[model samples]
Target: MTNELPVISLFAGAGGLDCAVERCAEPPLVHDGSGSPLRVRVATDYDGTALQTLARNFPHTKTILEDIRTVSTSDLLKVAGLSKGEPTLVVGGPPCTPFSKSGFWIEEKRNSQDPNASLLDEYVRVVSEAQPEAFVLENVQGLTYRTHQEQLRRLITGLRESGYSVEYKVLLAAEYGVPQLRRRVFVVGRRDGKPFHFPPITHSGESERDREYDPSKLPFVGVKEVFDGLPATPENGEIADGTFGELAAEVPPGQNYLWHTDRYGGRPVFKWRSRYWTFLLRLDPDRPSTTVQAQPGPWVGPFHWENVPNADGEMRARRLRVPELKRIMTFPDEFEFIGDRREVQRQIGNAVPVELGKVVIRALMEQMGYLDPLGDGARPEQVQETLLF
Candidate 1:
């Protein structure tokens, strides 16, 4: 491996996977991974809004705003000022909507005909042409479901044919120290055909892991810790009027609509297990929150733990503010977004938790003989900025 790892991001929605690779560059971070910093040279995506956010956050990386299917890998490398096989890593999390658990409700999405399913091939196309030393592909856990065997198999076969060794796992974000319990599948490949090491689990909660491992392990991060000093005051502090409006307040912290069912002692307005778990869900300050969806319904939650007083002076639960959302998503506190409130939510929700990405890249760097994943050393300065844009 060279002293620097040049990275190219494809289908780079809000640069989440790129952010992870960059974090790995700053080795010896909290989870103990160390290595030479990664340089993000170019990012390509069709959504201009998301590209804008990625551009502003990573000003040095060249940004190409176009559908990937129309863009050739040669153009991607050229924009980054690199020739074929010059890049050290290519990282991206192709949009996973059609492969999501929620998409199953729309039966057309259950089949491979959905256009989004084909984007996985776009990722493989770049790996075949650009031929980076390594690559990482991320998507929803449902992509691994038996129903989607064709798509998964095609992805694996394409990479293997590209002269690489493939390894993957469904990673839990909370287990890597993120405040939310988001889960996704990460597939890694090395051109040399050597197996890759996924990072070790660095966090565990009392209930999630065995009791005996408790003493030496770090507990899973909770929402409270993530939002410690942020004020509950958001642009819209008033709770929106909806079916669960004032009623969300009735449910205590660390619970959801299940609290309203007969089994849990609320008003019993709902049957047992009647709705999605996120319905009327409130944050449990003491534990990790559930998966953060790209588009949550009006009554869906993991709402802020703090309650606000209504006109009658009674308290009511409120939605999470934008800043809180960014924190929970594991983006830096000062990170900026380029869209309106709703779009920003989608960007944050769709991002790969940055810290988790760092862990994975650390493992990749270690395989290349650059990391000390268990070291206590401090993070070094970022690599020289790639002024490709």
Candidate 2:
């Protein structure tokens, strides 16, 4: 009567994708009408800070702070209480800088040290050894760029050779109720020879799709829809300080507090001057947030809230608080984040949006016949109707 599904995670940065997968696998759903909860027993990451954070949050899972590339297949399997070729699921994302647009944005040796950069090879190595029933790969949207086309093709070929039927697509975080407008590439593969199917899109945007998506059936998700009704934090006392300044400060309604306080107090917003201000301008409350950068330095936004303009023509706001940023990334209020403000921001920015992962995993499970929509109380007609929109 146990409904527990075994999962082994690699490159498990701050447990974002694992959190989503764990959430989707928990009771009220993943329960096989039994009370025993689904569980993720093993996770690994090379970063000490990330490992510590993962340990603090997911106390149930065993975490290893070691480079996944060096971890043998036997080492990983022993940690998971299983041997190679046992039926289980593997989920992970290689460190993405080498495969990212910003990474190739410049041609330099520094950008090439992408440790997780060789991570895809490690992923394939693990898949071949573990022989899991299914696997999921997460990465930056930049992976699909022209520069990485060949590397991607090779990864696909490797998975097929390992006996997996694979499919991939670029998924936007906003489409799954994350307030931020982040996009990532996902590769889902199964060992059963069934082609992986992408989850239906539940949100849309102004950008024209290659094929027109049904607006009525698959309604567009918006910024307001996700973060709306969430209470705003008042600009006041500092909660945590960072290189930018105090975690909290008071500025006009729509002005860039980061710009005003970045070693140049009382200065005009970024719109007025341009030096040292490379981050996106204040977050547009009316629209979804632009891509959240991995590192938000001085002159970069901790970002303003709501983008409200003041009488002086400067926008009033402060850097994004840790709570708000988590909300933007679609982390539930109860999902506690650990660490300093900067590290927290990095983790949140780097995580897979939980809602997006939920749909994708559900679709994959359906293709495997391991899950039935009707069993979950979702009627076939209703599923089709939801898909149309």
Candidate 3:
């Protein structure tokens, strides 16, 4: 172990994983880990906004905003001021849409090489070539589906064949402190025989460990807890222009779209019907959120507070906003995205939650002997900046 835990980031969406790793074990609280401060020396991604965000947040690091398939192992470490055999960490996830639980059903040949689905192989290629001491792969829970289960099985087997000890599991974001109920599949591998451990869930409301733990136990962060401090003003300010015509004209507070129309005396009005009524009805706020889809169409939307009904006397189902989405993904408020609204949403929705990554990384670091359990003093400084394009 050295003074800096060098890192190589792949498919680094909006640098959420990088930011989270940087903020893993900072001041005030100390972490019991085995690795040095995780340093993201090299971050590579195809998306311009994502790469720019990574660069903006980690100016000292080398960012390659190009197709990762063409990126060679030497090129990655060379830019990071390192060489082969140096202890380094590689982390990233291939686009998990095909394996996502909410993705379109692929009833055909699962082996078909869709450009997006085959990207997982590229990740494995980099791991083999770079030969990092350890690596982390994150993805949507869909990777565990029965249809695409073989792909995941192959990925784990491939890592082990490459001479690494690998571990993986599906994790709930709320269990790690994020307000949103997002779940993801995480995989870790170490070239050395030492086994890697996943972080334990520390914040379940019903988990007996909540009361059994000491006062220093981590607190459960909820939706209200995350958004409580934000301003009450709407981002669009009630759609004042009424661009959506009558639908927008009488749009109730917190309501985004209407599925039905009503006409009064010489006036046409619109009505809102909750989409996916059954799913919305079962949203147990006391527990974690259901999976957040890439496109939160009418049927599945983020629910408002239970008792806090909107102006129409109906609880409006609105998609989670960008900042809220980022928070839900466990990205620090300081980290920014560099892209259009749609791209931003896609990145956040498609990303690995930061807090969850931190816990995983912390566990690995501890195994490598990098963290100080007892507060030893100065830790890395986390900067506050908008990294999104």
Ranking by lDDT: 1, 2, 3
Candidates 1 and 2 compared by lDDT, better number: 1
Task: Name the candidate, 1 or 3, with the larger lDDT value.
Answer: 1
Candidate 1 per-residue lDDT over residues 1-389, each given as its tens digit: 34556899988888877777766755422323343368789999998999999988888889999999999999999999999988889999888987898868787787756788989999999999999989988899999988888999999999999999999899988888888788889999998777998888888874333344354668888888878888756565446445677679888887888888889968788898889888888888877777777788888887877787766776778878888887777777767899877788888888888877877887787665544445432223221221111
TM-score of every model versus the real structure: 0.90, 0.78, 0.75
For residue 167, model 2's alpha carbon misses the true position, in angstroms, by 1.0
* Global Cα lDDT for candidate 1: 0.80
Best by TM-score: 1
All candidates in order of TM-score, best leading: 1, 2, 3
lDDT scores for all predictions? 0.80, 0.65, 0.63
- Give the per-residue lDDT of model 3 (tens digit) for 241-331: 2233333223332232332334322223334353342222223344444444555533344444332234555333344466666655656
RMSD (CA, angstroms), candidate 1? 4.8
Backbone collision count in every prediction?
4, 12, 18
RMSD score of candidate 3 (Å)? 8.5
Q: Which of 2 and 3 is the better model by TM-score?
A: 2
- Two-way lDDT contest, 2 vs 3, winner: 2
